[model samples]
Target chain A: DVKVTQSSRYLVKRTGEKVFLECVQDMDHENMFWYRQDPGLGLRLIYFSYDVKMKEKGDIPEGYSVSREKKERFSLILESASTNQTSMYLCASSPSGTGIGQPQHFGDGTRLSIL
Target chain B: LAKTTQPISMDSYEGQEVNITCSHNNIATNDYITWYQQFPSQGPRFIIQGYKTKVTNEVASLFIPADRKSSTLSLPRVSLSDTAVYYCPLAGGGSTLGRLYFGRGTQLTVWP
Candidate 1:
């Protein structure tokens, strides 16, 4: 079984603070994705990395960035957290090839609250 | 990625089969249909994927017709644990790479 672990399950941060959410996967998959889930918006992609040090902006990457220093770890950084940033953050990984058709494994998710 | 439309919610009883259908009228030829189940406060879990015809897994079954415009996810004899949101996303090949559009999924509630 594949395991994707998020660094925190529940997080709280003040406005204007820089927040970091970390995720690590055990299966060594080449594709990692970050998404934020809001009430009516569903799961909107924030960022994704197909290789180490390579990242692409997703549909909603306005205030967020990602880092993939190693194959097993992907981190999402909130440059300046705001109350609007409070939402559930999810991380997922999938094997290489076939692009969007490949099955992805996901972590439990990190519930972030920006006050 | 093609936009998918599914029911907002469904109600079912235990020991009964639940079929959730998603419509993707603009699905490309190379696009594959994928289903995901997400529990409250958890990330979406991949259930099944199929291009056409039928594909069955331990968790669920995916049925896609020849036109490839829609797909149905069948969960057999569901329990309370099977209650979750089911998302049907069309995943295409090539440079799109790991990008999926998850619309508001069908929320299924299984009762005892």
Candidate 2:
């Protein structure tokens, strides 16, 4: 079965601290994405990558950056964590195609808390 | 990308068929409609997808009208487990990359 795993399921950090969230997919999909989900606002895209070393910003990319040094691994970085950044972060990957019809496999998200 | 609109919430009884409709008036020719189910605290899972006509799989059925202006996702004899937030995503045009946009999906609650 295809699997997407996150490095951490939960994390707590102090304000102004740097944070990283790691995601790995076993399906070898070419596209990976990071999103933050908040109540009423829904899931907002942060960034996505089509290949190694390639990335693009989504609707809301502020205060976040991404790295895809390897095909199966994608990392999301919080430059300096803030209390407003507290939310559930999800990582997803899909095959390289225009097929929005294709299902994206997702990792069990990381719930981050910044004080 | 085409924008989709769906109900904010709906209530249904167990063992009843539930149909949730999504409207995408500006859907392009190459765009396909995809439905996803998301439970609380979990990521959304794909339920069905279709370009035109009726498409059915093990989990659910997708029905698209001739005009392609709207689509409906039909769940057969829904159970309490069927309660979830259903999102309808519109695919980008031909040869474009897979960039998914999530809208405020419809929340379905199945009761006994």
Candidate 3:
């Protein structure tokens, strides 16, 4: 079984504060992704990394960035947390391939609250 | 990625088979259909994937027709734990890399 672990399950931060959310996967998959889930919006991709030190912007990447210093760990950084940033954050990892038909393993999401 | 349309919600009883259908009218030839189940407050879990015909796994089964415009996910004899949101996303093909576009999934509620 694959295990994707998030650093926190519930997080709270004040406005204008920089927040960091960490995720680690045990499957050694080559692709990692970060997403934010909001009511009525579903899951919106924030950032993704295909390999270490390589990252791509997803549909919603404003005010957010990602870091992949190692193969097993991916981190999402909120440059300046705001009330609007409060939402559930999810992390996923998938194996390397043509990206066709590959199953992604996800971690129990972190519920972030920015006040 | 092709946009997928599924039901907003469904109601079923325990010990009954549940089938959720998703439509992707603009699905490309190389695009594959993938199903995911997400519980409340948890990330989506991959259930099954298929290009055409039928593909069955321990969790669920995927059925796609020849036109590839739609797919059905069948959960056999579902239990209370099977209640969750089911998402059908068109994955892969062309320059999509691995980005998956998830819409408002079908919320399934299994009752006793």
C-alpha root-mean-square deviation, each candidate = 1.3, 1.2, 1.3
lDDT of candidate 1 over A7-83, digit per residue (tens): 99999999999999999999989999999999877899999999999999998999999999999999999999999
DockQ, every prediction = 0.67, 0.68, 0.66
Name model 1 segments beyond 4 Å from true: A99-101
For each candidate in turn, the TM-score is 0.96, 0.96, 0.96
Residues A3-51 of candidate 2: C-alpha lDDT, one tens digit per residue = 9999999999999999999999999899999999888766788999989
Summarize candidate 3's per-residue lDDT along A1-57 as a digit string, tens digits: 999999999999999999999999999899899999998778888999999999999
Docking class of 1: medium
> Model 2 in CAPRI terms: which quality?
medium
**Model 3, B67: alpha-carbon shift in Å?**
0.7
lDDT of 3 by residue, B1-112 (tens): 7788998999999999999999999988778899899999888998888888999989889999999988999999999999999999777775666778888899999999
Identify the leading candidate in terms of DockQ: 2
Q: So what's the TM-score on candidate 2? A: 0.96
Instruction: State iRMS for model 1.
Output: 1.8
**Candidate 2 lDDT (Cα, whole model)?**
0.89
Query: Scoring model 3 with DockQ, what do you get?
Result: 0.66
**For model 2, how does the per-residue alpha-carbon lDDT over B1-112 read when each residue is reduced to its tens digit?**
7888999999999999999999999988988888989998788887888889999999899999999999999999999999999999887756556877778899999999
Model 3: pairs clashing at backbone N, Cα or C within 3 Å = none
